[model samples]
Target chain A: MDAAFSEALIALLPNLRRFALSLTRRPDQADDLVQITVERAIAGAGSYDPDQRFEPWLFRIMRNAFIDQTRRRKTAGTQVDIHEMPEALPTDPGPGLEARLMLDSVRVAMAELPEGQREILHLVCVEEMSYAETARVLEIPVGTVMSRLSRARLALSEKLGIE
Target chain B: MQIDDETLMALADGELDPARADELRRLVARDPALQARLHRFEETRRLLAGLRLAPEGEDPLAAMIRGAVTPEAPALPPPANLNRPPWVALAASLAVAVLGLGWWQWSGRAPDGFAPAELAALDGLPSGEVRRLESGEELAMIASFRDGDGALCREYETSGGDLVRVVLACRDDGAWQQRFAAVTKADGGEYRPASGEGSIDEALAAIGAQGPLSLEEEEAVLRK
Candidate 1:
């Protein structure tokens, strides 16, 4: 139990929370996800290789926690009705009323994306991960990451009506 | 040749070789529809970047940390100072709301403004070592040789405020290359050199005090 591990975890909390929220959509669930991730990280601290970067390792844990939660929900026969979930806002609010409208539209469009596409979109595009890193995090092949990202972009362009 | 999605993604991520990229650029120049599609792909990436993380009010990380540290703590406590006047209570509630809003705005939750290029630059370093230096720190060169780690990691901070972290990993080829380097906000919001002498001497001294590097020792961890 190195003291610096706790400090590092604290520094990473904000980004972890954001990533969890994007994955879970619900605040309570996102918090739960983060909690589980922290516990797992703490328990497996010894397994953390010092050579690799910490953020990605932590992020991989967070992603696993999210997937595990989803799997548990599925096993319990609890299906999430995404239609009832609240939406995420625009990154930039821009000006006034127009900005608000744009945000609403963006939120709706984001909500309509499939979970797999949305996850890749958030990780690669929003988080700015390289394809190789994204593949490592998602446990998928690099080609899959490329194709998924391309599909996600195409869908978003259609939904946003971007020429 | 019109680039496929794979090639386009690689190009957009700057993963393509210069010659390949040049060939793609030539193709895009001659193809209107392909160019339009490429533009759309780029715009889509920008729009995704514009998708802000959920606002601060819903931060689960705080709750997660609290829960992990104090699993048996009580969930809620009785209201304190309940005898205050109604107006005071109202003001207090408003104040709490305002403080919450302000915290969300400034809680270091927003992006740290480190661009992908910066991260890429750090990744390009040889030893996988980088550091954040404090401003106005004395130029220092500290080399710590830990028993178990093969080569010594050299760290230093420049007067110009760059903190540099470097590890000389012994490769199979028996050559040492600079591994990791990053430019981050220093103690006074200045650049910290990743290695060398001057202001970074203090850190080097500390590492030197620790011991010499050994074959089994581990290098310092790099944080993004």
Candidate 2:
């Protein structure tokens, strides 16, 4: 059963990384965040409720781990890394150069957005999670999820020059 | 009828009810403004989809997280307090949870086959111990007990911090032979494994116990 659960977590790596990237705004930091989240997950596994969906449980762990990492960095006063504010776009090849440019535009715009809004957008729009699921992941009210995501989408659209 | 941002966002994210969705579809068809608004959301979703961090192919990130660490984050730090490496700290912690779990096991009235002094020592043992492995895994022993057949068994747990698992492993030869395992229940902070206890009881019933092992017999069984 643990093996099955671990396999389930493996299946969620992409989604987890996507959320981590959205929160951290850099590939390396996102990877680090995922690693920390997994470490905390393993350490805290004894507390997991098997009856519930694994994704939200995991998202909660990742969110908390990200929070912990942020807190620690804040305490350490560590210098921010360059990759954190990455200007490089994601590697997915869009349909055309124009499409690629637009994707880059969205990526930059997404980076510019606050972490809270970006996280909601990734959960709702990119990962296709509903408002309730996104809310549960972020531990916010469903209405807050909707409002935040609406504002994020509007922001992304305006920044991308979408009509 | 006017649509709020929440409803509009829900409709755009495909979260609206079918009746409402169909009505919205009809509304959009008749209203180019609504259609364009929906299209904008869809187009943004599309553009974002193209920015997926993990591209098509085998998901290397899972394997990476399972195996090695990227340069950004060190795989794991050495356990605090002890100068020894992480695995050694884990071994120590396991001994600690085992004792706690050992206490939890003996605290039960059933024929667990552990002595009172041994059970009482659990209180002396520390709590909230975290055992880690060389492979970047963690262990949390929920409880452990011997079956009726006198097989020294342990009902411990394993976690990668993302998922917790409760396992029943009976001593066979020299190593723990796993008999049962399942995801740990995170019922708030304090968790009681109902199924895990059921498995331990089931193992005793299936194997047919000779009642609780005496002190000498338990020592002999555990030594193996």
Candidate 3:
């Protein structure tokens, strides 16, 4: 691998970890997923198209790795519960305690969403991925991305009582 | 005209065409129910954006991957001047610059301290707004607050190349003085939730900062 590719992969570690956390929910599993994703990315770096954006390509790799891991875990009869207690949520004192609590609720509500909706919401709202990019990442139609993201937002709003 | 949820969501996310977005904006402005729906999308996005993941230290696997990628070197020395708390290093440089010290060779920094573009951002960029420079660097104003001395101060974040820096600058004697800064690796396009602790919290505590100013309050301060 070239220097640029290695550097980019290293820089994207935090993003990979966050996405993995969203997928696996457990921090330990999230770390393992990130490791697996980086290993796969490096192994397949030669196939990555230089002209395309790096993020969607990397994210696709992560999601695929997650699916593979889930299948293996299912066969072993050791599936991790999706509702595993969350680690202590981050508290941002800068935004004040009230806003911080509201954000905590947002995280809790997000966890309750359907897996498809949760992933799309994280991609669009938190990661700020464009609809086209999100579609590429999720392997879905752009229309599906829009409708899913819209539904996710509405679900979140209703959960939070934001009329 | 009835607007679909997808269209309203797209408008809220800034994914719609400019002309169509403008049209919807006008229509939504006239309808209270539409405004509420728009607010739902907007507020959800805002709250979600606030769900910034705190950075745990780099995993050991990263080192393993680094080793695999590098053919010649087993390990590279960590980037220089970053092992220590960045604000401590930045504070020294800021002190030097403030005392009319000789020019120091900090990359992307103006000789007088603030980059011309950064000064422009400090002057007017509202909290939560982001500006992209011609050089592909992105500047985001995080918030504004009053320091212990009641000076108006702003906290902003800048990312370019592979590094993101969060800085606090205060208005002093008709100029913005660089106060505190912390650096971290850029995680592609992820929304960086300013971590609660570490150097930023230390800076805030040392400065006796009250809290972030509201939009109206920040605007009032900027107007002066």
Candidate 4:
């Protein structure tokens, strides 16, 4: 692997892990998504345009991996049991407990959202992607991205009990 | 323009054009209720931003990477095709088991060993002594002191950079003991201990500004 590619991969790990966790709502699965994305990116390093923003390309790969997994699960007739998910770390006496509880509520709220809304929310809010970039990733118009984001935000605000 | 949800989101995200943003700003300034509503919406976004995405116990990315990197092992030879006898296979299995056990034993993941340098650096300082290390790093050494709960409390920073407030009390045998420990991030990012806080002349002033320290508590921690 090229040195630049390796450096980029390491730097992206934290954000990629965060994005994956948002999608899967489970640390292990999120890590799996990130790992798969990295492996695929590494394997197809030649296909990547060095001039472009590496994040969007990498996100596309992660989204594909997630879609593939979802399809596989659907075919296998097996559902992911949220309760069986592994813990992220040891429970420390700090903001960790409160953070975890809030995260649980957020995950539940996210799951209740429509798939399109969820994807757009992840891309825009979590990933901090622009509407144009989100449009490109979702292959939809920028108007659609804005609409989805507005709906997602309203739904999330209601779910989280924000006035 | 009557600022709707889309416009509010755009303004919050800084996606609005400068002229439109200025207009919205003027509107918000004129209307307190609109400003309050905008503030609540912004707060909701901030709260969501702070939410943890990863649950406890799992690292999905690590697992995924491990799965990708771990090459599939070559298929084992069929039992019928193997020329080795049952005794030979059993011996091989035992050898493999022994190797695995030895590897586990040699792994240095145990928490028993403390870094000698760090421990030594801590040792020279007196109880309640706030010393700046050679690297200009300052640390507070608090001794177990009696609190309202009648417990001895020794507060210190954990190795992980967390400020731990502990409550300790003297037991029946006269040994100062820890009652409870609460880990919290230091406010205002102030990790450096205040100077002149440990001296006898400044002890009263220090206690007034900071807090008290126990003599035995200092000795007990130094022994660690």
Candidate 5:
């Protein structure tokens, strides 16, 4: 493998972990998902078109790997309880008490969102992927990305009491 | 203007074109309700952005991937060798700029930059023909085309030792000058030469290359 590909992949570890966490909702499962995604990406590196953005390609791989893992777990009857999963939010000491409380409410609100809406929201908002890029990663059309994102944002606002 | 939620969200997300966004901005400026609706999308994104995972130290998983891919063989050139002459460094930077990879090994000024066999292959072989030299290096001319300046250029692949390099050269002042080149280790299977046009297209765009010439067009151009 080329150093460029290796470096690029390494640089994206945090983003991959974040995306994986958003998908699997458990840190441990997210790590496992990231591992599988990286392995598949390296193995199938030949198929990656250089003209395309690397983030979408790698994110697509991670999403597909998550789907595979979910399927296998469903077959084995070992799915984790979504409600029991730990909060994926960070407890940054930098924020003041009031800001932290606001962040906590946002986290809880985000957790209550439907899986599809939450994933799209995290991909677009947290990861800062463009709508088109998010669509590619989620394997949906641009219209769906916009619509789903709009719903998620609206839902989030309702929960937060934002004007 | 009765802008829907999708368009409003798209505007807040910076996905809408400038003209539409400007129009929306004007409307929202005058309408408090419209501003409030737009604020919802913006506020949600802001809160979500605040939840981004803080950057951490080197992940062990990344270390594992790095170790697995890097073999004992020196697949990449040493840092010292990259201190090329200014013109070559400029060309190399252009290669890096286009490819986003520091794999271009464009040695300056042939007779030394190119092997005699490589030069012969480019001159004598037609596009889509492969020739193996006595030295055992396999050279394949993939395609030929004219740059936006109408300069004749050829894309070729050469594999020898453990590295495969794809190069684009344009004929200038009766001599073919290397414009772009990317080298990758042959064993990794990371780069497939036949599928390298995507990367080459960026280089072609950098040089403003027109589409590849048909074989007949290439032949007629070569005869001129």
Candidate 6:
């Protein structure tokens, strides 16, 4: 985690944060997830192969961290209060308020999606990770990626009144 | 020919081979249903693109992170016994997973009880400092950041001999409040440093982030 590596992680932070937010559904948790992922990435930096795309490798760590964290929280019964909800992504509020509202509606709908589908949608649709890359990041089969992605899109479309 | 949702999705994502994609394009030129399905897929992609959070407010946590990730920063030790069966587990993950709580933290601050020295651990000092107190307890700052609600928190530990307390604390109204903590003794009466995933990571995920501290914000935290 030298300056160069820190710079590299910073450059990817926005995307990494975005992916984490999608998974965590809140900026704060996303930030923490990003922090934890960076910790795991930096700690496991020695294990990273320079040949692989760093993004997926980093994503894998976040996914694993999410799993590890989620399992523990379930056991502990910690309650995240209303204050912990993620702020909607800031959009131009003037002319785009209605559009933003509609988008907010979609965000609400996305939040309703099953964790698996939501994750697939975020990776494939939001981050635009290839289905192949997605499978690798999620440690799922490629076919499962396509099926889950299809379901996520259909569900979102239905919820958003897009038919 | 009936177009399956999967094929339409592939066409929209440009995942099909060029030959098949070109053929579909020709079909879509004439087939109203195919065109509608493709439009649906494209629109879904567009709507979902809004999922990315815009950096609007000051990310008060950025600087702490920037300070923390340096090569000089304490590395999160690789989980001990990764290959070993899961003996040690996290405290609570439901705060992040089961409740499915969307991101947002309540306004105002909660009360906390830890001493000032303990509270300072949340200030994002680069890790790896091993400070030994007069009591012969070793206190270390593993990492720091503000949770989703903007409260500063630290993943830290205090150790003396056979007993080690791994703790996660967040500053609530300027005092350290412990959200999660656990103590585990070394197996067979031998003391080894603790390493691996624990309550801290789980607690933070549930806590959420307002944003990372911007460099200036980190400076401000340091100034305080």
| Local accuracy of candidate 1 as per-residue lDDT tens digits, A1-163 | 3556656777777677767867877667777777667656765666898887777788899998788788767766654543465443224335478756765666567668888987888887777877888888889998899898889888988999998
**Across residues A92-151, which tens digit of lDDT does each residue of candidate 4 receive?**
344677777876676667767777777777777767788788787777888887777887
Q: Kindly list the interface RMSD, in angstroms, of each predicted candidate in the order they appear.
A: 11.9, 7.1, 11.7, 12.6, 9.4, 6.4
Chain A TM-score relative to the true structure, per candidate: 0.82, 0.85, 0.90, 0.81, 0.88, 0.86
Best by DockQ: 2
Return the lDDT, model 4, position A78.
55
DockQ of 2: 0.33
Candidate 1, position B93, lDDT: 22
Query: After superposition, which runs of candidate 3 have C-alpha atoms over 4 Å from their true positions?
Result: A78-84, A88-95, B54-59, B72-224
Cα lDDT tens digits for candidate 3, A1-163: 6668877887788788778877777777787788667756765677899999888889999998888777767766655544565443444556778887887788888888888998899888887889999999999999999989999999999999998
Across residues B8-45, which tens digit of lDDT does each residue of candidate 3 receive?
Answer: 99999999899989989999989999999999999999
Candidate 1 chain B least-lDDT 10 residues: B95-104
Q: Which digits, one per residue and each the tens of the lDDT, describe model 6 over residues B173-198? A: 86667776655443222113342344
**What count of clashes does model 4 give?**
19
Error of 2 at A158 (Å): 0.8
DockQ list for all candidates: 0.15, 0.33, 0.23, 0.09, 0.32, 0.24
What are the TM-scores, per candidate, against the unseen true structure?
Answer: 0.53, 0.58, 0.58, 0.51, 0.59, 0.59
lDDT of 1 by residue, B45-79 (tens): 77666565444453444443433331232354321
CAPRI quality of model 2: acceptable
Candidate 4 lDDT score at position B34: 80
lDDT of each: 0.54, 0.58, 0.73, 0.53, 0.73, 0.63
List candidate 1 stretches off by more than 4 Å: A75-100, B53-224
User: Between prediction 2 and prediction 3, which has the larger lDDT?
Assistant: 3
**In candidate 5, which residue pairs clash?**
none
lDDT of 6 at A75: 77
DockQ of candidate 4 compared with the true complex: 0.09
Sort order, TM-score high to low: 5, 6, 2, 3, 1, 4
Q: How do the residues A5-111 of candidate 5 rate in per-residue lDDT, one tens digit apiece?
A: 77888899888988887787777788878877776676566688889988889999998888877877776765664456545444677789998888778877887
